[model samples]
Target chain A: MAASSTGLRYPSNKKTIYDRNINRTKTSELSRAAFAYLFVEMITYAQRRVTGIADLEKRLNTQGYPLGLRLLDLLLARTASSATTSPANLRPTRILPLLQFIHTTLWRHLFGRPADALERSAANAAEYMISDNDPLVNGYVSVPKEISQLNCAAFVAGVIEGVCEGAGFATDGVSAHWAEGAGGGEDMWPGKTIFLIRFREEVMEREEILGRAG
Target chain B: MRREWEGEKLPRVVFTLLIVSKAGGLIYNREFHAGLSKQDTNELLIIAGTFHGVHAISQKLCPVPPAQPPPSNIPTMPVRPSGIEVMESANFRLQCFQTVTGTKFLLFTEPQQPNIDGIMRRIYELYCDFAMKNPFYTVEMPIRCEKFDRGLDGFVKATR
Candidate 1:
């Protein structure tokens, strides 16, 4: 094979992924079915040769990690290019903006609807929760009867971790948990998923300094 | 267009569908009408592979070269001529549309069916939503999305 100056080989079409614009299409919507099938496959792949539920969930999360990293750059470029909404040249320097960006912009992009709620943890200052009622992925997947503890949305959590890491916000870990009947919620909306995002000590410390600066 | 004052029916049937991956592997196959004779899965896979090869050769066999556009600063998508789009026989017809990403949709329909291209485009749309966007779908692998099946069922029913 003939090699280019850079190691990346262009396709027969003579176009590289770099030649294409990532943020070109905005109005197109993804079918929930696509996400559902993908989620099921991810679970199936992770379930193979697995020790326990936690290990399976961890594998699913790891699978989605790189997707989040790529989306972080793509989405930031999208927001910066589209000037109609709030200022175009915004990169999330602080924790609040980044969280808000994920809660609103990223959620809407992925799920077509904004997250149900975003709340700070009462007990842990570093922990934040973003909840979605009847997540699109969960809507179509009926978890098998055997492993009831598995939350397929852990893949989404992995994506959030990638975004946070890409955006320079280090986190202790991000995870997905079923918030069924917790905190006096989801009585009307069952299968509510709460994404628990916990920032590292350094992140909270930096937030402290940033808050003082403002 | 025929007058629809009777409120009877519109189009005909989509007998079957075969999806070939960019690499020419048979990724999906489904039968809609019960009457159409079925081919063995192995036979279908070979047909798909054969068609992929023929499609590639057909592009090279084009008698005339496409005229180059005036030089421009912006890079453009390569405008290669498409391969065999429609094949007609005394009994049924085969309609094919290949996506830019190289995934091919082969739709078999009744010979008299109209507006097959529109239906092909719609099928492509469904594939984009259900197959391409799927995170677990390794590119060029078999597509097994329940939503895609449901969507197709609904679409075919409504079309009929």
Candidate 2:
């Protein structure tokens, strides 16, 4: 209840993050160059004393995880704040709706556009893929040939992982993979990235139980 | 009016921008215009270190303002010395803009160039966006970002 050292006094009533208005300000654009520079610095910092490319990616993913968690609430709050919508209606209960939320709403909020495609894994029922022809985060990045397997989009994958976990959908792991020229050479997006999201077996079991009840 | 006319006659060019960290390290050094001859990397580092020392000493040399009795109406913030801001030479002018966090931006420009303050502001804005916000940028380290370079180039060129 006491005032903090910075002289910021919050009322005795504790205000939660959700209590604040999310849409107080209209949509604003940030400089992409700044983001790229910061991302480059992040990569450089992560690369320091790292054993391999995988370790660097893990660091990037960890950095993005918190952002994803925060964004999930903010994005949903924005949708729920609109006059016509209720919070109940906005809550994504099913896997399909959750994926749709990420594919359309989350992508649009972060990248200014919807994902290129959302697909179910042909080989695995537990997996889903979100494709971005050219992820904005990777726009200014060029991975070295020696670390050819490394994709900076792992940060985005971490965000996806955060969103899934925050939404009560337990996931085993989320990974980013380069799928360049998958849609043929004619496609404009050459740096195509596919984020493979795999749900845990417990989540699948819960979904099956809920399916029968619904 | 006279200054504006003179400014128009002489080309407005930003020769270079050097960023010195709080710890007296040269974190970023970039040259925009090709006019100035490049200095050795060691020389640049020495320059940064010397400037940092001078800047700190200059702050100490500043005379303390006379204290006034607390007023009921207005809140007063503590005053800190703003060290050497500008250095002028025969051919070029050097302007220094220091941030609240002690990062210094030194811009070398044409002697007659106008609105150096505005240029400094934009640069700071770009730094905040690209460098500070970047999750990967650690404090007090060299910045080697293609985007930051490209953006700085575009901004400077567009202004010209």
Candidate 3:
């Protein structure tokens, strides 16, 4: 074949990805500086063909969605297999438990800490909010005055949507935005990103039925 | 090492393996046992899409509503519908395993085959390594990873 003639085969000493252990890097940590560098590169790449800030965020979000789906399965598998945890790998079926899973397990896995806050929106029955005091994705990104309304956390919001959808909790939409300041709110945490999750009507209906049944 | 390599080279399972992408496209299909009628690529894609839609509908199917607010302790855990997991007929057995990300693995085996779940899990592990982690592989696209095909073939043979 053309591949062999061109000597495209990888040498054996350099183990192919398929030969590597899935958990080889589980406990290892990556340098934040390296991550920030990559984050900046991704943002610049995402910014290339955007009509507006909203469009750029949407592009970043789509990039993160696949990551969320992959991580949902990967993390669940790791939790089930890891000796440090209980063997039972239970997917949260109800809204409360799902929120708790994201708030604690998912947040910790991704950011090395639990999310700052998880709250239900008072005005909407089907909406919930998860807040991050300082998002690493936003750490390297600084918006210009014209695009100040855009939040790079939209990528993380897409990941959340992917996880929720993968876990069978259909979301109508998930988005990230800056929290409105009560003047002091801005001073306290300038980089705070609030992820808004709006669940679909079907999910809400199922939740109601399950709540009644329980 | 030789045995592991042999696993990939051999085709010995009396089962068929199918992988449906998250977007309801058939990504991979292999029939180790070929007595069943052959399906063209278009037909397979249609089947995958139909299955995906059916699974979504099943997930959305309403649970049984309690007549009134019950007194208490109707087994605290909530009831959730997990879409079709298995189907059996006179000639063949069908088992489906849906990943958290909406990918479906459809395994067709002998009617009386055992340990389908374990085999499914092994295949899922192979997929995670050979397909999911492959940089050349695109999300929700047809998987053309050569190692994936060989790995799945090997794993299935070893299991058999």
Name the best candidate (by TM-score).
Answer: 2
Model 3 chain B poorest ten-residue lDDT run: B129-138
TM-score, prediction 2: 0.63
How big a share of the true inter-chain contacts is recovered in candidate 2? 0.12
lDDT of 3 by residue, A1-214 (tens): 5445442245446566556566654666787656665666677678787898789888888878998888888777766666556524677789988888788888887888999999999999999999998887775454544667988789899899889999999998799999876367766787788999999999999999999999
**TM of each candidate vs. truth:** 0.54, 0.63, 0.52
Model 3 docking category: incorrect
Relative to the unseen true structure, what is the C-alpha lDDT of residue B10 in candidate 1, on a scale of 0 to 100? 35
In angstroms, the error of model 3 at B21 is 50
* lDDT per residue as tens, model 2, A118-175: 9999999899999998899987664545677888999999999999999999898798
- Mark the regions of model 1 whose C-alpha exceeds 4 Å error after superposition: A1-13, A84-88, B1-160
TM-score of the second chain of model 2 compared to its true counterpart: 0.88
Greater DockQ among 1 and 2 belongs to: 2
User: Chain B TM per candidate, please?
Assistant: 0.83, 0.88, 0.79
TM-score of chain B of 3: 0.79
Q: Using TM-score as the measure, name the better of candidate 1 and candidate 3.
A: 1
| Docking band of candidate 2 | incorrect
Q: Return whichever of 2 and 3 wins on TM-score.
A: 2
Q: What is the lDDT of residue A22 in candidate 2?
A: 71
lDDT of each: 0.80, 0.83, 0.78
Residue-level lDDT of model 1, residues A91-172, one tens digit each, is: 7888878888889888888877789889999999999999888777765554544666778889889999999998888988
What's the residue-level lDDT of B135 in candidate 2? Answer: 49
